[model samples]
Target chain A: MAASRERIREVVDRYVGLVASGTAAEIVDLYAEGATVEDPVGSDVLKTRESITAFYSALEGLEQRTRLLAVRIAGGEAAFHFEVQTVADGVTYTLAPFDVMTFDDDGRITSMRAYWGDDDMTIG
Target chain B: MAASRERIREVVDRYVGLVASGTAAEIVDLYAEGATVEDPVGSDVLKTRESITAFYSALEGLEQRTRLLAVRIAGGEAAFHFEVQTVADGVTYTLAPFDVMTFDDDGRITSMRAYWGDDDMTIG
Candidate 1:
């Protein structure tokens, strides 16, 4: 059985909320074991749970806020556009990446690929 | 060589424009010879040009307009949110689907997967 749309939407909501203030461990908990993550699309994929956790750990100390701009869920998969505003070293940077994610029947993310490039970021 | 960002943006713009007014053949021309299309993600993938063309032909006479809400291009692929509004029998239907497309070096689309379900559509 595929994940329900309501379940997928709940995950997305939780994901954005966690990205805003939750710990890296909390964020990684949303994924199933052995899930793969490739943020920024061209980057190397992180296939291990440890590596995936390490990747999200980068945001642990950052002052960031996230918002889900839009999302469409279908066929146990979701593609969403979300904004992440981070403040680091007194400079504010905004990046909105569109992520494509596949989920298991239990609603845990199985794989995620985010689409964004240098041109997609803004600095102020 | 990978397709340049400018070329990818151009294709996206042209695609939105074409979808609003062009024939199915014109829209299918943006794809490579053996490209595949899986609209609404869960639907059967259209593997051949004829099938893809037939799929788009459904929009042929409908009074439809399209707008590109947002788009991100990375690693020779693009994920975009776009709105398509169609008027039929005095009713308007609005659907915004997030599309992920991989491009060939020549800037032609190689594969397209759209994400949207019934909940994503609105009728007015």
Candidate 2:
């Protein structure tokens, strides 16, 4: 169980590192070919590497400090609660995002199902 | 087991039914006395029933239709992915919300942690 938690944290840490560094591609590396990213607009089911780049480009204002709130892992599936801080069009916004990651035995992520909204800014 | 899944569905169904019917009190009944609810503002560790009513009354534009997207139950904790539709201040908004429910053995929900953003209006 501890090993599973460690693996789960590693996956989350790696992905967060990418977003913190503003490198969406590195974050995309954690996803499998058929990963699905969902949000208010719709859902994305990836089939190729190129599509990953397209998906990242479509998202704007992703800067430093993307935080993961919680994680729950069971077998090949893991669910995460996240908050992403970004600035879009010169206005700062905080979006709370949740993602479910499914992985193979080799630790390669098989899918990423995400739920996020751009208008989710928090008041401090 | 099949029984566990059915129990899980019952919990979810009951909760959603309360919200869909705009019965915040009924929704409160689904929780244990000290359930914790989390959101962007902060976390609530409900020690009494009044806090639940206070929490519900604080929110505006919650007329109808609170949807639960997905649910996963393991032991005492269950995580649900949900979307709630409401109209606030004469403007329509669709909020994508998620809740994690913790229940005791008797099927009484002990806690309900909510994550939702008011700006999450779905674009059709």
Candidate 2 structure quality by residue, lDDT tens digits, A62-114: 55467876555544455677766666566666766666566765566766656
Per-model tally of clashing residue pairs: 0, 1
Q: Which stretches of candidate 1 lie over 4 Å from their true place?
A: none
- Among the numbered candidates, top lDDT falls to 1
Model 1: which residue pairs collide?
A: none
Give the residue spans of candidate 2 off by over 4 A: A1-124, B1-3, B58-61, B117-124
**lDDT per residue (tens digit) for residues A1-124 in model 1:** 9999999999999999999999999999999988999988988999999899898998999999999999899999999999999998999899999999999999999999999999889999
Q: Which candidate number has the best DockQ?
A: 1
Compute fnat per model. 0.86, 0.00
C-alpha displacement of B15 in model 1, angstroms? 1.0
Residue-level lDDT of model 2, residues B1-124, one tens digit each, is: 1235457569888877676664567667777666655453234466667867677655533665677765555444566766666665666666555565667666677766554433334633
Model 2 TM-score on chain A: 0.75
Candidate 2 backbone clash number: 1
